[model samples]
Target chain A: MGKDGEVDFSIIGLENEIEQIQSNIDDLENGKGGSIAIIAEQFAGKTTLINKVCSMNKNRVEMISLSSVVKDEKKLQEIEEQKQIKIIDNCHFLYRHKIGGFDIIERFLKTVTSPENKQYITTWNIHSWNFLENTHEISKYFPVQIKLQGLTQEQARQLILSEYEEGEIQFIEDPTENKEKMINFVIDNTIFLNKEIGIPHLKINYRQIKSKLSRKKIILTPEENIFENIYSISKGNPGISKAIWEQSLVYPQIKPGDIKEPCQDMELDNDESFILSILVSMQNASRSDIIEIAGDEIDIERALQVLSKKNIISSEREHYTIKPEILKCATNFLRRSRLV
Target chain B: MTMVGEESGSLSGMPSIDTGTLLSVISLLIIAYVVTRVISFLLTAFSEKVGKYRIKIKMLLPILKFSIYGYTVYYIMAKLLEVSAQELILFGGLLGAAIGFGLKDLFADLIGGIIIVFEKPYQIGDKIRVGDQYGEVNDIGIRATTITTPDDNYVSIPNYVIFTQSVSSANIGNSEMMVVTDIFLEHGSDMKIARKLLKEAVVTSRFVYMSEKHPITILTKDFPFYIRLRAKAYTRDLRYEFNFESDVSSRAWKELKKKGIKPPGANLIDSSSMPDQRDR
Candidate 1:
């Protein structure tokens, strides 16, 4: 739904770091303030990941998006008076507003931390490596700094293939000549950008490229071995490989599948149907918003948890997007079986 | 001298009897008693018609009874002694002083009773604290007051205590008053989640009134090594204060379990024993 190589359920190489992030969140909640700066770059999934963590807590945590109140002092004071956990998003405005606006927030934090009152949870967004360098003064108060990085190629491939849940991706021998070029393109430009593009997006792009190569009937040398060689160059950068593969899919070598009629007669069980319907209807939503739309239903939470464990749907931010292959499977299941 | 002695002897021989005068004195006393009885009856009837104040009736009955007796004694003594006015006046003065000294405490108590009735430092059915004892005032009398404490102990204290000691009167005449309860949880607990659940637990309780604008607050106090979470709210009735307290605490505990939160296991010290010497 976003970039071509987004990671699915697995965080992959950042396993240790993810554990640290979990603990850091726990520490922040416990009112042990030791960190000063949080540096997250663009498309780094900072907001999404934080939201996911926040959801784990059902009632104890009150996540407030600070971007909504960056301008109004009165409203912010009211929120501070309520004394709940506050998550401030879109903090790029700190640079935009010239930091003076944050003075009120600083005052609130000082009062909250003082002996007279209770400590509160506060989260603010800071982008780029320079966030730590620029906010040297502000960072003195915030003791933790977490840097967000993108997914690796293996992680991306796991995400894409796992989208189908029961099956793995099979790279058949490419009989077409263009497979060499597509594979080479993936190896050269894609894996190098693993930090940017996630894994699932890469496979979707590769799938499209494979379709194009088959249509042209060009002679491709060592077709099945292409993925291995491409992976060698791509390394683990799912984003780049996905991007290159996506571009390769548009070449004349490919033949497009005939569009089937939309499945209108599908009748899925509430949990399955609702999950699939929500996926089909919204197309894309942040992880937070999905939890919210689930409303008061415990079943929805269970469904999401099951789906996440099964790697059918992956989340970024508040939006839970369907993996391209999962979407296709769901579509095929609905069209053929009419079971939503 | 011989003639005077004979005359005195003759007078003494007559036994000092004054028949007509004695007869008139007896008649007068009989008449006076009748008059007193008639007047008392009318007064009693008038009082009954006017008001039903038991103290007023009690006061009037003693005065009337004494007046009737006094009149009879004065008339009989005057006829028998044939004393001078100056002698009677001197005797009356001495008698008054003796009575006054003997009844001084009784008089003070009576005045204190009057003060309580009119001044109304507290009224019946008022929850009050006199000196160190706290209770609801069930009866207020001229000489003493009756109060029922929370433990259902009924105590009778002299009325003068109201004038002498400081009194804490809550809803002195009204029935509605604020009741507060504090709950403490352990440190390292999920304060945010714990607080929310506790607040919901307090406000959602059936005993809690919903009209209040401010919501129930869960205050977190961080001591040297532990955190204390206190839940405070108002209740509808003072009598239900304990019920409200226990209900809120129990509900909060259950909610904590449902939310998968464990409160700090450390024992909580009741803060009531600590007095705030400083101004609040």
Candidate 2:
């Protein structure tokens, strides 16, 4: 986690996105442009970037981080009067997902587009940004839109290891000669004398094949393979990669095979899917907010229970959020369903 | 022309077929069938896995099936039976005449299926209407195109209908399809709020898919009895067309009623015809 005073490069591998944002800020400081919207997936470091921007600009910008839905539309109007630039995080909370949920967002859009001397910087979930882009052409209002990309293997390594001292952690290798074999001995049941028998079935591991093929380009040392596997599973997402790394770590030693893939499922009803989409857009939605948005047609408990059973989301103190490791899979599933 | 100088083993200008050749033909046909079934299963599984490329991947099914069967037939005639070019043409002509006389409808349907595959009128997963049947096209078979009606009824319309009747596809080959939702309000209702609520209802619907290319549009027109508010938006998937419309309409109506935007009273407009042109 980055501090408010000094921002770290926790959002590694997003130099391009940071550069684009910095260029936009430069243009704003010169009085040459409009507002900017930082669009990214949850836990992709939107908040860290905002802090970095605030600390870099010192007194020129004021930050407003919305922890929950904004019921008062007028509260947004009363920004720091001395600051010319305002950075609002979780801008997706500006509106709800119900019938009359768009009033506050509409007012905000109008205020931003009405030729005020001030410029605003906002951070939004990619899915929420997409919904607004389609409905209100939100992109037109924010002249600069920067989407944060995922971290690379090197960047993920740096981000994950930034906290630990050199040689404090041990990178252990696999005991077997064949670490990432493309072929594996998978178990299967075969009928023997009218009874089922378990036997070792020779199965081809396609993922191992891909990993092996990818090794030809960048071969890592004994310890680097752990980060590579974590990167492969997490897809270089900083939060997910770090989470997987910590879970796989045993005190000072960590093994490559310790990093396993997340569990999979094939069920999501319409209501469950809608709830997941809402949670993704909001990043942190209370149970009541979910029920209110889903309305009467949905059995909110069943949906929430199903999501919990699948380990796709976790709730604490009535607020639900997607698991960091499951974020990519959940997003992909939602995208396939067109819910996000 | 003359049985290839009598060395190709022809009987009455027809290719000679022995027991071995017949077995080979059967084996070839079995292999082709297995190949097509496996390919179909894999492609369908993959298409389900990736929704964005569902149509593009499924569109390859008919073509792949045809290629496999076409090659199987060609191999059986040209290599297994060792039929000459001239003899093959003569046999094809005879078969064509027999089909023309006895199975005209079947042949027409076959040709229509071929046209559907190549001409790109509509493919699998498209929302189409043929004659009076409207639904999401589930499968495009050799003889007919099967669609699951909004009522969830699987209706198989003959492919030949593409030639005889006017066929319309709401979404040509894309997953996002435009759905028209209408909301009627009293003459003295809050028009601006109704429009705003309708737009919000559409944009906020979980089933809706919006982008710069597929925009949500709301239009209003004053009718004799009341003003009709129509919302034109694209559903994420054509299969969710009705659900999207219902989602938008119900939510918009709920908000409209709360805001005192009363629906036009019963019997104010003609029950039989409410100017469907009020759509669009």
Candidate 3:
């Protein structure tokens, strides 16, 4: 009721992009023949930048996303007719095996960006430069190129702060204590900026914070405290962070001010204790390797299945690896738990 | 020829040879050699013919061929020369140590090959991961195992390595394996919404299989600024993981964004959570 829809700001960074994208829009509005492409690595903010341009020119320009329309040329033509600014999001998917030919791309580009159509086009990819050779061959048809790189530290910091605020996430830090630490804390943990909704995305949140603190109360289970302590230490990577948090959260709820000594006070269920042992062993394994090793054991498989379902771990073929932030958080918890 | 005759005479304990005796011996020697060659060829041809019907039998062609030749030579000595079969057999035993030392690895591989045939650690068309290498078993041999990888490269590993090294067989000796994909959402996003979107994504996807074990589920936990949201679903076939993952990820992203759920903040967490050297 209080604008409290989880202050999830999906927009962040791209300050420099906002201006260039606006210019692109202006050029398109004037019926410019040139096309622009934004490219980056996977998860490197390519689509976000292109989307920002489309959003900036929303009313003045019509945009179409051509990612999923692989086998259907008609759908693409239809979208082009409906939209003024044609943007293709998953351009890679179109070229992958039997989907389409370069002729389609060439035809689409020529039709959309022709002077007669008075339209503009933008394409997004993780690596725009990789398309340089191909685009050069197609230059006689469509010839605009733009490459996106990683964010600057300041931009990254701003990006992170925005995501946190948008999420309505509260940091327990007192500003007067050390401003540098606060900024560095957010900057170091933040991977990138959000483009659609502006906000810094933190690596961890309040529920995780609560779970880390509630490892006490289960009188019969003490080992759960290790999981709780580890979750707190992990700082929220989905994989290890949840592993520790879930293990600890299963314990009886405990207040934040309950007491200091986690090792001496906490209790855990047998299953929680068993999970902690594997989690502890998992500290030394990559997510993929863990999946490989644990594939045979029902309990380990169950744990990994749960972990992967939680997005704590990812698998490619026989290999599995925990997400980066989750790894960070889980290890931190382990270190802290060990210290305790 | 004189020296050969002298050696043969000493071995045979004959004093001297007349022209008729020498001619007869030479003809007999020529006949024995010809007979052995013809028999060897016939045996090898039969081995090849048998090999076509059975893989295990095919792998034994070299051994079977050698054994046939060895026994044939012994037969020529015993039957042609009128020498005792026991003497030929004894001579083979005396040469055993020499052959063994020279062919230790070969012998080991051969034995390992036999083990492979009987133990059946892998067979043709089984997906297997051995050490750092993963591929489908193309053919199993007595001394080596041939595998073709997903990249289309064929690798031949020694049968002995298979016996000694750790091997991981996926799909539990079956052709099908569960392929899963993960979907991430912005922190504080409606978990129910995300879950529903993911379930829809999986259910709507052509590749996704709806089974009791593979039911899609969404999980939530704190991940930095965003509550790390994940939707996981399984594919009955492992080969579709690549396509399924891309499809689900893109769909889930579109759904989450359309629902107005932003991604997590970019801010870093407290430095205390940064990995220590010990974490690795």
Reproduced native contacts, each prediction: 0.00, 0.86, 0.00
lDDT digits (tens) for residues A1-340 of candidate 2 = 2457554656567667667777888888788888999998888888888877777777788888898888797667667778888889889999898888888998888878876567899999998898887777799999888888888888888888888989999988877873657776767655599898988778676667887667477766767888878887788778888888888899799887777667453457778988999998899999888988999889999899978977899999999999988888788888888888
Q: Each candidate's TM vs. the true structure?
A: 0.30, 0.86, 0.30
State the DockQ of every prediction. Answer: 0.00, 0.66, 0.01
- TM-score, cand. 3 vs. native: 0.30
Residue B172 accuracy (lDDT) in model 3: 43
Tell how far residue A189 is off in model 1, in angstroms. Answer: 92
Q: Across residues B70-146, which tens digit of lDDT does each residue of candidate 1 receive?
A: 66777566645454576578667886786587855554665666666566666555578887788877555445677
**Root-mean-square deviation of Cα positions for candidate 2 versus the true structure, in angstroms:** 4.9
Measured by DockQ, the strongest candidate is 2
Task: Return the top candidate by TM-score.
Answer: 2
Please provide, for model 2 over B103-188, each residue's C-alpha lDDT reduced to its tens digit, 9 standing for 90 to 100: 88898888998899899799888889898898888877778999998888999999999998999989888888898998888898
The reply for model 1, stretches above 4 Å from the true place, is A1-340, B1-109, B210-218, B260-280
Among the candidates, what TM-score does chain A have in each? Answer: 0.44, 0.87, 0.44
lDDT of each: 0.49, 0.83, 0.48
